[model samples]
Target chain A: MNEYKILFTGTMGAGKTTAIGSVSEAAPIVTDVANTDLSLGKERTTVGLDFGLLTLASGDRIRLFGTPGQQRFDFLWKILAKSAIGLIILVDNSRSDPLADLVVYLDGFAEDLSVLPCAIGIGRLDTHPVPTLEDYIDILANRNQLVPIMSVDVRRREDVVLLIDTLLAQLEANTFGA
Target chain B: MTILRFGIPHLSDPEVRLVKAFFRLYSQDPTFRWTIVEGPPYDVLLVDESVSEDVVAGTVLTLTPVKSELPNTLERPLRSDHLEAWLKKAEYDLRNARLQPQPPEEQPIDEQRIDPTSSSHFKLRRWPPPALLGSNPVRVRMATLISRRALRLDEMAAITEQPLAECAAVVNLLRGAGLIEIQDLPDKPMTMGRAGGRFADQSVKQSFVSGVRNKLGL
Candidate 1:
């Protein structure tokens, strides 16, 4: 079976672990530690990478990895992102400025992003409606970026599947020049 | 059967005949009776948009607000299709308005004091809250955050960086789910820049990433 590597990255408390866990056939392997960063508002945070696995209906195997949310460990982002077919950036809209949060990931993966298919999932939209979908579109437009953006609650298995499906669709569109 | 009335001010004989023909076609549905009244007790007003604002304002002011509902705009040169569409929309709006619950005064008030220990009221405590797992990740996060403390809607909005309306909606959802408590907080100035500078090279990297992702068809 063809194997594809997909990476999920986002801010702390953005539910990267939960998102992967929601869809993984087996329990996700997590590297969580006591969070000293009280500002993140979570007791335990992912210190290392989170890993999960899934088999697509087409018989392709997907290896899902979630990078640590903190930028301090961003060096791992590139290491984990290597050879990945697609990237999913989960933005927590409840943060002070979600668009800015998106910018951070977009910037961190600037190199890999040039050649890799990517999808943006804006979470907490129901809680944070500012910098709306339109605002995100405008921000992406100003930067000359056109990628599929959707409001997602990553905790739901269907939502996580949708993000991945959207990424795959983008890859397919690119292949067929759709 | 519901009855819907239409009124047009200063309508010519030809215009009245056209309107009557449209209503006749409309009446084919048979769910409601359609009629054209000379004045007063009308459910819809077909106002010509081409008329002067002053004239339109005067005519509107003279019309009873409660009696006349769903004021539809009629172009100066009316087409049959346009008139038919407008009448259909107006009829829909009037029917919806009628179906809506009346004001509190119009409703029969149930003022009987409820015994909190009664079976119906007692079921409130027995109701199990919904699992925090759902399609909305923000609500799940908010529920976790608010479980630690009671927060006002705006504070939740600010903390979550979600719109006030969305935050309010989540709050309402959680309240319905019986997961968190909401309390009014004294209005205070929101301090900015707290979330600023948490990460370095955010803007530069974000722009580059966006550009790359855009190029990659992400």
Candidate 2:
């Protein structure tokens, strides 16, 4: 009962691993390997999963898990979300179809999303602001979702912290008012 | 040049003509080139005082027959001097607003307060950009509550134990930015809502989450 899990899922280059590593107490265990998909221009890719851990003051631990980014491995998304208390969906705005990438994860976790407090972190927005945050909002609103979304640089620990706090704030408020 | 399009939806033909003619010679503000357009998508809208509904457009200027006490209302028999004065003021305000605005002005008490018993719901159309939300964890907490369901301001404040003004500021700020939308509250309240769906097996205690935040220095 001391362990809780949070899931992070997004497109291949959206920084889920970096986000975990940014806040993890110990080195996060990532299952990334040499990328065969060079179109994304990355030497390594997470094929299985990425794991990080945070040990709280009370001896409790929160487990951070990142699901594989490709659609073929979407099956693992639900499995990883099984006991998750929250979800953080990252979107790489610079991608050709970041909106579509978002849909894949949203639909992938639709069930888990129904019960899990979630936040969205859009990366690379400083340079690529076209599919603006407003654009993402339209898509989410159209789908009847009310999840909080914001731009993030997973490389910045503060941004990653803000993203996590966004999710936790959701849970804290709901639990307080539930 | 940014076009400061004005719409005189409720003006008579003669008044519109006169106003348009005057605007043609208004060479004062280089901030924006002003134009008088027919409708919707207006940056400055002049409406009849009789029209009380909110204009989904920019600064609404009401045309009243006599001097009105409320801000932004112009009395009819529109004097060239008065019109010129108001116009110059508006141009300056609009220019500065675009320069970058702080959260919109505070909401009036009635507008900011909501009766828990009322039926209308308020929800966010989008999360406010980080620029607006900026470094305020409490504001983020308020935004999260709002994004989850159509909670009244009182309920939202209570949920987070934040000041009513603080929560109202967040809501109004987003509302001004067009991120918060007003709609009928859903027939069924999202019990335990999407975010708080109690884990089927257990609930994560508040203390546990706080501890994690502390350990990470959040």
Candidate 3:
């Protein structure tokens, strides 16, 4: 009966919605609308967030929440970020600066939301030659930060499960006194 | 569907408490089927089917064979009709996934709003930057330290040379960032001898339940 809320966030077209649909049992309840922002270079933007519900075999259900990619929607992110047990931060590999995108969410969370459990899923590692997990971890490493850095194909379930499991374990450690 | 086997070399640790993680996430589904196997990764969960295209791309620590596929084993048994039926029910939702619409009042929850109170339930303080040897010196050092041993509060403080409260702060920060884990002592840390021993002992089930409750922040 217990359900953990899992959120997928990152840059535009980082595959957040697809990742949720790939693993969700019930059809993912998505707020995916075409991008209209000029940042998209005249592309469509997701005016709202995407939604998915995944019930693990243990009967534990996790609501997969996806946030809009634009920085302007950062306000909405604070509201959507409530009760999130883990974060699957989808990064766009094709970009020249993926670290900037990572920092965008990292700083956004630190600035806007409550301190909650989270992780980084290096999305689109398959398409672009980004840093390795070890390399990326090095980029995000700090003393107080226990971010689990890994490459993730948003479209895969096993990868999502591993990411979710790692996040859940960390959440448990945080909640249960480790 | 692609089924891959992975080994998590450290599951044997009595304190690792992995089953606690596994059961917490999977115990709800009536039709879920999983088997834990022992191998190089130390633990393997047999997923009956694949979940996404990205599932196959992560580091292939190595693709291990299922127990039934061992060279010396007999032929694999076929699934019975009932077993097949169970798989169908479980697979139906996964295979035929769609997008469900949310009602207007029920807006999707964002993690930032999860804790709106001014008092911080989770507090984090940063550790000293990693030992600078290479480009990502700090991250590498921290990862090595985390994988090697239990990163208790005192040890973290020793490294940062900060006050105990500050040490707790830093640990919480690292915990939030997903860099380390915090483990509570079975009872208050100061308790000793009979006073500590006299604390109400929990039954196995109670202990497990309590442990889970603590982790879930329930």
Candidate 4:
């Protein structure tokens, strides 16, 4: 059995760590630190990376790598995106502009992950007054080509699993040329 | 019909696959009664091994039957040598059956040998607090060194209070991102450089101070 590597990349505080912890069967090994960086005025921060190992029921283990979202550490994201089989671009809707956040990450992918399969998770939309999924998709459509995008609570098990399943299906479709 | 029972730890994938294969192959025999008993937070395999005592303490192997006779009591100790021989033959296949982690610091026996509670001088004031952030070393480094203009890996080790390897790992990550520029002042005596050097920017200093404040709640 072969295991695939998946990556979770998004803005800071977008729940990358929470998502990994919720879905990972093993206690997710976390690399987190309180945000002290004044670069983006971040009060809470994840400077290095959040990595977790997930064992699927098929007995194949998939490694989930969560990269930092700050523009200063763009180098790390590029390196991590090289071997990434799929990308989970988490969007924070509670922030003023979801579309702007989407643009930043999508632009980053333009360099390293050209044509890589991506699934956008619109986080914090449940509490915030944000547009619906259709609105979110339309928001993405104006930018460039649209990928499989959905609103997800990164903290929930089912939502994270659904996002991964989408990514796996996309990978299979790509690999088999289906 | 020699029916023997086994108590097994968590079954590995390879072990389960092998068992299923053997079960399917032996299902053709009418006298064989291989039963799987799952109960009480443990899994047991009931096999009719002719050579009962042959099975080792930590293995699952196929047993060949020499006769057909169910022992009246099911709690009989496994005394089958025939099964043990089979285990020896299949031991290679089971090598990767379980995935064990790299040896932990302080082996189980070592932890047991040292009674932390009993050592009055060494007694921990508190269990180490839950990490405020996850175990990302780079973040820890940036969090720690963000305020400092210049930091040696040795200085980082001292600041984080972690071992050299951990400190090196954190520094390497920060250096990779161009967030830090490492200068090797090998000739510097006593590993002493000033704390919070002038090289750090106001932003980096503020970030570092905030991080320390958040972490220490000072």
DockQ of each model vs. true complex: 0.03, 0.25, 0.02, 0.03
lDDT of each: 0.59, 0.74, 0.47, 0.50
i-RMSD values for every candidate model: 18.7, 5.3, 11.1, 23.7
lDDT of 4 by residue, B40-128 (tens): 21113333344355433333433233432433212222333433334333333333432344378734423432221221111111111
Candidate 1 Cα misplacement greater than 4 A, ranges: A56-60, B1-218
In candidate 1 chain A, where is summed lDDT lowest over 10 consecutive residues?
Answer: A169-178
How high is each candidate's TM-score?
0.46, 0.68, 0.46, 0.42
| Residue range A12-63, candidate 3, lDDT tens digits | 8777878888777677776766666555553554667778875544555567
Ranking by TM-score: 2, 1, 3, 4
Q: Per-residue alpha-carbon lDDT of model 2 for A65-88, expressed as tens digits?
A: 988999998888888887787899
Give interface RMSD (Å), model 1.
18.7
Chain B TM-score by candidate, in order shown: 0.35, 0.43, 0.21, 0.25
TM-score for candidate 1: 0.46
lDDT of 3 by residue, B1-114 (tens): 111223233334431234334422342344343222233221132232222322231122221233344321212232234223433443454334313555766543233222
Any runs in candidate 2 off by more than 4 Å, and if so which? B1-122, B129-131, B152-161, B178-204
**TM-score of chain A for the candidates in order shown:** 0.93, 0.96, 0.83, 0.87
Once fitted onto the true fold, the runs of candidate 3 whose alpha carbons sit more than 4 angstroms away are A1-3, A37-44, A56-60, A111-115, A142-144, A175-178, B1-218
Worst 10 residues of 4 chain A by lDDT: A169-178
For candidate 1, the per-residue lDDT at A151 reads 76
lDDT (Cα, 0-100) at B54 in candidate 4: 42
